[model samples]
Each structure stands twice: as C-alpha cells, then as structure tokens.
Target: MPGWDDNSLGYHSDNGKFFCHLNMTGIAFESNNLIKKGAALYPCVGFSMLQKSGIGGSAEINFGHRMLKYESITNFDI
Candidate 1:
C-alpha cells in the first residue's frame, strides 16, 4: 500500500453560480507490483483541480433515481 496526504483549497460563488476545488497530494514512498523486496522506490507529488459553472439553467439536474446532469465538469492532473 502507498501512504498519501492531501491538501485542498476551494471556493464558491456567493450567488451559487460557480465553484472550484484544488488538491495537492504527496506520496510518502514508492511501491511496485512486480518487485516485492529490495526494490528501488521514490517519493512523489501530484495535483488536481476541478472547475464548474452553471449553464442553461443550473449547475446540476436530477431525474428520478439515476439520471443526473452537470452543466460543466473540468478536471486537471499533474
């Protein structure tokens, strides 16, 4: 298993129209599936962010039990 930590920052519009969230993940160690013992490992970091806005009518819509609609969804990774 790999140990990890996350730091997050977020903001939302006062009018409930727009929102964004950012996260930074830090890995404590390296892991490999094929090599179990005496394997080389290194620590690393990652980042992600999401931004969404209301369009047409609202940011989201729901129908019955399973249907859903998102105005916009954007994701980033590094």
Candidate 2:
C-alpha cells in the first residue's frame, strides 16, 4: 500500500477511498486527484500480484506530456 507509511498518501480505485499512514480517511472526492503544496513531493505508482500465476495487469501513464481522452486541469503547479 502506498499510504502505509508516513508522508505518503494514496487513493484507491476499488473503493474510491483515500489512505494515509495505515488509515483510511473515509472521505471520497471526485476530481483529477491533484495535490498542490509547498513541500517537496514525488510521483509514485504501485501494483500488487496476489495470484501466483495468471494474467497480470497493466498501466499506461501520461505525465502531462501528451494528449488525453478527456479535458485536462490547467492550474497544476507541480
């Protein structure tokens, strides 16, 4: 889990929940999931493989360098 430690946070797609430091925030928000703060932050992604042998998952990430299928948010400063 990405938010299992201090200074880390994660939003889950399965339950639409946010987690931080081994606890769920219990508040859900609908947005592009952006954070703007003065502190230094890094981008992260995580995956889990519970099955021993099966078809795994995949991800395609676009770090604001290409076109997206939907409208983009314009005020991100990080």
Candidate 3:
C-alpha cells in the first residue's frame, strides 16, 4: 500500500508491480462489543499495474464480495 520508487518525472521503470485496493462495508444491528448478530454488505475493489522488462506495462481492476459471519462479528476481512 506504500511506494518507495520515485516517479516524479512520470517515468516508472520498475520490474515488479504496483497494487492498490478499496473497500466499503455496511453493517446493521451490530453492538460495540460485537456480541450481537448482524447483517452486513461489503464491496471490495482492487487494481494492479505491472511493468516488466521489454513487456511494457499493464493494468487491471477487479471486484469482489464478502459475507459476514454470524458467529464472528468482529472480523472485518470476512
């Protein structure tokens, strides 16, 4: 989620890849201690750009969904 390479001149010659992601989550009937049951809706988006030697650069975007567990209301990744 962080970058160390300098691209101030708009030139990125890295041989690896650059990645990013965004997520939004909604929950209802959830308590502060996460001891109550709740319904949740989450939408996640991700993007990546790859630059390889003599291969140029490519970019991609992806979307996915996550369901909330009734047994575990404290988990955000699920």
Highest TM-score against the true fold, candidate: 2
lDDT of 3 by residue, 1-78 (tens): 113334211212356764322224433332223344335423332224455544443444343355433443434656
State the TM-score for model 1. 0.20
Question: Across residues 1-78, which tens digit of lDDT does each residue of candidate 2 receive?
Answer: 675666667555777765543213423332224543334345677777768686567888886699988873444633
Q: TM-scores across all candidates?
A: 0.20, 0.48, 0.18
> Can you give the lDDT of residue 1 in candidate 2?
67
- Residues 4-69 of candidate 1: C-alpha lDDT, one tens digit per residue: 333322233336775322223422222234233332334333333334643222333333386445
Task: Kindly indicate the candidate among 2 and 3 with the higher lDDT.
Answer: 2
The alpha-carbon deviation from the true structure for residue 74 of candidate 3, after best TM-score superposition, in angstroms, is 28
| TM-score result, candidate 3 | 0.18
Q: How many backbone clashes are present in model 2?
A: 0
Candidate 1 segments exceeding 4 Å error: 1-38, 53-78
lDDT of each: 0.34, 0.56, 0.35
Q: After superposition, how far is residue 72 of candidate 3 from its true place, in Å?
A: 25
Candidate numbers, best TM-score first, in rank order: 2, 1, 3
Model 2 worst lDDT run, 10 consecutive residues: 22-31
Candidate 3 structure lDDT:
0.35
